[model samples]
Target: MPALQYWSFLVAIGVLVIAGGIFAGLTIGLMSLDETNLAILKLSGTVEEKAWAARIEPIRRNGHLLLVTLLLANTVINETLPVLMHSLKWDGYKAVLISTALIVVFGEIIPQAICARYGLQVGAFFAYPVRILIWVVYIIAYPIARLLDWILGHKHGVIYRRSELKELMALHGEDQEGPLTKDEVSVLRAVLELRDKSVLNVMTSLEHVFMLPLETKLDRPTMENIMKAGHSRVPIYASDRGCIIGVVLVKQLIINDPDDAIPLSDIKIRRLPRVTARIPLFEMLHVFEQGGSHMAVVYDSLPGQTEQPGESSRNGEALARIVQPTWTYASPRQADSSGGNVLGIVTLEDIIEELLGEEVRILGSTLRACVRVYMEITGRL
Candidate 1:
């Protein structure tokens, strides 16, 4: 029994070493396979059919290689062990059973559990070596890949897709652990906003927008009134909302005489940046940053739509009677749909307030403690 136990222990060590080697080989081979697949894709044409074929062909070839290698290695190891044990005068069946059990326990299960626990760290440690192996395999596989391509009568080059890059970005976000920080979540949300949100979602509605009439003269009282309004800039429009002449800064008004008969056209900053309602907010942010402007105007819905009169009706008689223009800005179209034509305005302050509100709710206990500490430290009740 003691001798049997010693033999079993030795067999277990041998099995673990062999299994580790196999694992390392497969890991290296899989890395090579991935590189080859990418190369094939890179050399293929931009056409969808060609690209798909290029990508799939390499995967199929590598998968076949992997299956064959695993099968052959397992067969050789299992058969040779039994034969060697028989020659050594050990009971063939008992030796084979002991070796197989050891392999399963020590070689496969235990090592795999350890690797799984520290997979990312292990992968990072071997990253440089794995990369070198991939580069070497790519060069070696190039001729074979070309030959296969020729035989298949397929295209020889690949064009990378932007969708693949986007997928990589999403995969990165998914792999991160736990809940994302506020800023990280915001950045990720901002990225998604590029595709989903249009300029209309971020823009101030036409009703809420302040504009100067092209014919209006900038006199003392007019300038004073504009100054008192607390807006840094105002848009100048022609006869209607559609013809936006330009934007005028309040500081520019200060530079000119208050009583000067200044036509809005003379003070108007021409070629003001404009974005359609359908433009994405992420793209609009870039436009805003580039143009040094903080505001955008959202247009009203198309004209001539009538509304039914009811309590639930947004444009009902009750609302029409009760709603005052001074309460909010309204578009002409909104007035037709409801009693008013105004969509809600969202300012930077509004966004900041909303974020702060959410943060306060989430960190209620921390905030309470912080306040208490501050009050105690300052000797204030």
Candidate 2:
């Protein structure tokens, strides 16, 4: 009878160990999936990926409950076998040693290694059974899970503010989170900042921006002056330099007879879109894309007492520029009160450069030819 009881304990220990292995593997396997990968997998991936996604979905949704259940079940089995051995007249210390060795080897080491290394393969293999286990166990586990949920409160997902997201990217850039490298994070950060960029960030200020007056004859010297200003696009104003109306490409100078008696007004061109200084730069890019135009005029709001032009604002400060589109220094009498001030000039190239956070090399053939002509005439390198 004593021997019979000993054999019974041995069989019970073996069964408990196998059950413990399933619990251990399920815990590690289910948790190993990244939520993003799982989501992507569900949305039209390969057959194997879709299969794994389907298998893992339920366990992932009920993760907390599944985890707690697995832990509770393992704990019960581990403790019960040892107590059962002692009940069969085995010594306490021997029972403890045997149980610990078996649990550690079978319950943790073997199962964890298999799941960790071939998680998708082995995990998908057992996913259905593990899923069934959760459902069966959830009936018992839900009350405690609900009570804990009530006490702690559940968040559907992480919410980050723009500043917080920047900080997180900075942290990842430093390699605190591992996989992401600094350069990659920097690109990501630049993209995030694109939405926040205003026309003021990229537009050439009014001071340096080249504006051709309608009264000025379209002569070689005037064309040279506009080209030397290092801008591919120039604004044309009527009589006053402050009242810009249309934009012209430098290439137009190369194609046209600079000696033509045509007034600057006769030059065929598109009117510039007027954009507010504070509007998002991305919106400007989108419009240029949809409308197929390159240049925009940036206007400014009334300067606050604390915030001045060419300096930082106390609220959402911006970099300084020469012109405030739709804003002017002229008195009401001198400047047309109806005509909004030109804050600055922004080109498609400027927005592209801003998006990439680097200057895009767009050397014009006309600009180069003009430079070569000047170089040959002066005989300087």
Candidate 3:
């Protein structure tokens, strides 16, 4: 067996190989982490991850510099290995083979494998030493780093688009060990899509919405019908179905004597906010939040859109019985004069349903479901 002339030379060879491995590992590992990954970790990562990110961030920020320093150190250490092997009483050809095997297996492949999987932790642990290496190699590495920066321009961090974020959420949902459940991912994806949707997508069409004629009386039967309708608020129309006046709260009508029936005009009618169908759901939500109104009339404002000539009916039946008005409470903001054909009605529940990716149930929703079933059975919807 070929033996080394001095054991001290063998120790020097081991040190060089280890140093080469560290340099190779740092190059692949630390460089993989870009600005955005670091930022996300700092903000939402686990405690250990946050600490690791904080340690690595400052060093990784200067991408070109860190890259050049690590690569240069690794190259130099690899070059010195064969020379050290030759000095240890090894023939030139055997030394070359030995050095190549050591560099490929220990210095490159093994270290790179470990670093790729646990880069953040590894990089953080070696951050201080890497900083010192950068300083030591600054004179040579600085020029090359500057040239790269000038050629490539500064690196801009990754910013995900709405669709990209949805894809990412889907990926997370696929991971069994991930924090988000499938339903949670679906809801989050819906939230990101809210800015793309409008009231037109969620509104109950005008012909399907329940309303009351302004002249309708709150007799015992009518009160019972209104309660059975299950709406917290009901729109009041005047002259015709197109002429929506305002809305009256179901709770407000409870104080009236059922025996002594009162007209809708006799009660306080709150103004219904109006919105264009083209407005995004997010903007519509902001409108509802600011105005403190749970309901709004969706309208089509496109020029030359003609009004369909028919009284609005729900599920092939008139929701409110038409009778001559004893009194009319006409607000200046009535729907008929609002410069658009009423398309439908949208409520807070509609937006919430969109966000939740499911239909929301309110008090009278069960009755509405039955009505939908009835309509479907009769083929009137």
Candidate 4:
């Protein structure tokens, strides 16, 4: 063959190889972008059935096409180069070595590595174009996708599973470089807390609660005596503390004269709301929001169930009912009422301290468990 025709053929093969390599790199880049988009869609709960199907179908088709095209281009170049070298009277071994080195280093490794690392960034910049391509392919592939969907009994769109969120949380925890900072760890722990914490975790036990007998006459000296003891609201029970009738605000008592005989029924606030010990803390927040009250009365504590059974039941039930109810105090009226009856008085400050203490205890236990598990797994325990 003529020198120019031979050189032309070699140049064409080189161009084809380079083109295939670029497409391969772009395919890898697109896959990375797809993963990121899926992550965002999952997190935001915005992955519509159509959109998710549309998002993935084109990538799959293009990826398949790209793989075949690259393989064919690679084979053609690999075969053509040796023939070209032989015809040119060049050493076939030398040409093969140089071409392999060039393709591996420049065409494959460096370009693909760059694309992989910055895939999402490049994908974002090219999103408009890629989206157009995806749309075009989606239209063409719709029939096949629909057929597959029908056969597999797979629905289109984003269906949220609890497991997905758990996996995401676990992935986030794993991605942190070192020990997470206090705030970061607190946030992650708080996410986990949504599932774990219940009303019993933060409530005050009934033993420590100050309650007033419902039959007790709202006599001057009696109210005065309770006030002197520094209780704000006192739970008014019909016969015993367990039979709570309502909560009485001491401030309401102050509004009456010291010597005045105030009727218990008139002074007492009716319709006191009570939360079950098993209620989740997050759900309990809504109760606090609607009640326009704080300081909930926690009922009976079952015997032998305390974390420290030896401790008095009094302290255990008191500790259990002290949840910090979630409420947005947009104005002064929404603020916690000071000086209330002590069916159980849990101040915002008290709740904060309790939560902080619980977090510390949980973190300590978690760390110890992790260490123990690790040691056992490594046979170093």
**In terms of lDDT, which candidate is strongest?**
3
Q: Write the per-residue lDDT of candidate 3 for residues 311-338, one digit (tens) a residue.
A: 2322212211211111233342344473
Order by lDDT, highest first: 3, 2, 4, 1
lDDT of 2: 0.67
Task: For candidate 4, give the lDDT.
Answer: 0.51
Ranking by TM-score: 3, 2, 4, 1
lDDT of each: 0.47, 0.67, 0.77, 0.51
Per-residue accuracy of model 4 over 1-381 as CA lDDT, tens digit each: 787888886786577556545545655765554433545544664445335534444444344333333344445555665565566666777878876775777567876887797654444454455555445555444555466556664433345465575555566666657555555555555554544565566766667766666556666557546644455566666655556556666655655543456666556454354444554555445345445665555433322222332222233243344333222222111112222233343322234444454422443244445434543554434
Stretches of candidate 3 above 4 Å error?
Answer: 1-5, 302-336, 362-381
The Cα error of candidate 3 at residue 259, in Å, is 1.9
Q: How much is 154 displaced in model 2, in angstroms?
A: 5.0
Clashing pairs in 3: none
The local lDDT score (0 to 100) that residue 238 gets in candidate 1 is 68
Give candidate 2 regions above 4 Å deviation.
1-8, 32-34, 41-50, 109-122, 152-184, 226-230, 251-253, 302-340, 363-381
Provide the TM-score for each candidate, comma-separated.
0.50, 0.74, 0.83, 0.55
